[model samples]
Target: MITLTDVHKAFGAKHVLQGVDLTIDKGTSMVIIGGSGTGKSVMLKSVLGLVTPDSGTITVDGNDVQRGDRDAFLARFGMLFQGGALFDSLPVWQNVSFRLLRGALKRPKEEAREIAIEKLRRVGLKPETADLFPSELSGGMQKRVGLARAIAAEPEIIFFDEPTTGLDPIMAGVINELIREIVTEMGATAMTITHDMSSVRAIADNIAMLHDGVIKWTGPVSKLDNSGDPYLDQFIHGRAEGPIEAVR
Candidate 1:
């Protein structure tokens, strides 16, 4: 459903996304794995049109990302940010329905609240949690809220940025399962960028390893262990010595 061909992006002296080429099939979950500063985020942002590539092209369902109505294009996507990113001032319901309460997807306040409650329930949050503030929730609950917000609009595409960050292992597992189930149920195309191997195994139908601003390997998850690509092997095994240099 999404495709990037020979994509390249650079910021001043920093050459990020030197030539990223990837394709995400419809209704499939794709996980991008890479170490810090390898431009995974840059590749994702290029697809989202948040970061323009210096060369090549990005298309979603055959339409060029750079030539669309920004709002309309963006409305088709949902994002679960790494930090949860909930507005501290808004109540839980408000935060979940923030998209529905304004702009292209606007709905009646009551209707939006109802939808928010349903989405919250899907993410394992109770309706009673709706009125509480972000500050009042535990870390796991806050993450659930973020997931609820991401699905509230029923977006065709979902992006997860380090979804398991800051959570305990158990909670991270829960989040991974929820993400997998929700994406499958909604039949949404998912693109997740995370270093967590557990999350990759739980959430990905396919995997892509990005390094040095390029896709070093891309294939089905079943073949991950045997890809024979040194870069991917180093990443998946967390090896200290390999083609990848571990900074001391």
Candidate 2:
């Protein structure tokens, strides 16, 4: 459903993505694994138009994202940022339905609140949480709110960035399962970036490893352990003494 070809992006003196190429099929979950600062987030931003690539093409369902009308293009997808990115001053329902309350996608307040509560329920949050502010919730609850917001519009595609970050292992597992269930039930194309192997196994139908701004390996989640590539082996096993160099 989404494709990137020969993509490149660079900051003044720091080259990030270098000739990156990837394709995500419709209704499937593709998870990207990489160490910190390897441009995984940058790649996601490129697709979202938050970071415009210096060169190459990004297309969604045959629409060239770089050339298409911005608002129209963005309406087709939803995103859950790594930090939850909620407005602390807003109530939970308002935060979850922010997209529907303003801009061209605006809906009536009551209608938007109902949809927000429904989405929150889908992510296993109770309707009672709706009136609370984000500051009143725990980290896990905040993540649920973020997930609810991402799917509130019932978008055709979803992007999850570090969905399980900051949660305890058990809570992370719960979030992972919730993500899998939501994507499958909505038949939404999903692209996630996470370094957590457990999250990758639970949420990915396919996995791609990014290194030095390029996809070093791509395959089914089941093949991750046996891929036999030194780089893949190093990442999966979390060995400090392997082909991958730890950033000093």
Candidate 3:
């Protein structure tokens, strides 16, 4: 559903993506894993056309990402940000239905609220929680809210950025399971950027390791352990000594 070929991006003296090539099949989950500052986020932003690349191309369903009606193009995607970026001012329902309440996807306020509630339920949140603010929720609840917002638009593509950050192990596991289930049930193409190996194991159908601004390895998740790539092995095993330096 998505493809990147010979993609490269640089900011002044800092060269980020040198030649990132990746493909995400329709209705499948693809996770990009790498250490901090390895350009994982930059790759995603390039695909989204938020950060224009210096060279190469990104296409969704064979259409060039950089050329399109901006609003129409972006409307097809939903994003769960790394920081659970909910508005402190808006109520839970408003936050979840932000897109639906305005722009081309707008719905009646009452209808939007109902859809928000349903999405919230899908993420294991309750109706009562809709009226609550982000501050009133726990970290796990906030993450669930973020997930709720991501799927509320019924987007064809979903992007998850560090889905399990800041949660306890148990909550992280819950979030991972929820993400896997939601993506499967919705039949949405998913691209997630996270270094969490546990999240990778639970949510990925295919895995790609990004290092030094390019994809070092890409394959089915089942073959990850036996891939025999030093960079990949060092990353997945969290080894202190390997091809990848501990200090970035």
User: Best candidate per lDDT, number?
Assistant: 3
- Give one digit per residue, the lDDT tens place, for model 3 in 1-248: 99999999999999999988899999999999998999999999888998999999999999999897989999999999998999999999999999999999999999999999999999999899999999999999999999999999999999999999999999999999999998999899999999889999999999999999989999999999999899999999999999898887
How would you encode candidate 1's per-residue C-alpha lDDT over 2-75 as one tens digit per residue? 99999998899999888888999999999999999999888888888888899998999999999969999999
Q: What is the lDDT of residue 120 in candidate 2?
A: 94
Clashes of 2: 0
Cα-based lDDT at residue 77, candidate 3? 95
- Clashing pairs in model 2, backbone N/Cα/C closer than 3 A: none
RMSD of 1: 1.1
For residue 190, give model 2's deviation from the true position in Å. Answer: 0.2
Q: Over the full model, what C-alpha lDDT does candidate 1 score relative to the true structure?
A: 0.94
Clashing pairs in 1: none
lDDT of each: 0.94, 0.93, 0.94
Global Cα lDDT for candidate 2: 0.93
**Residue 227's C-alpha lDDT in candidate 3?**
100
lDDT of 2 by residue, 39-75 (tens): 9999999999999999999999888887858887888
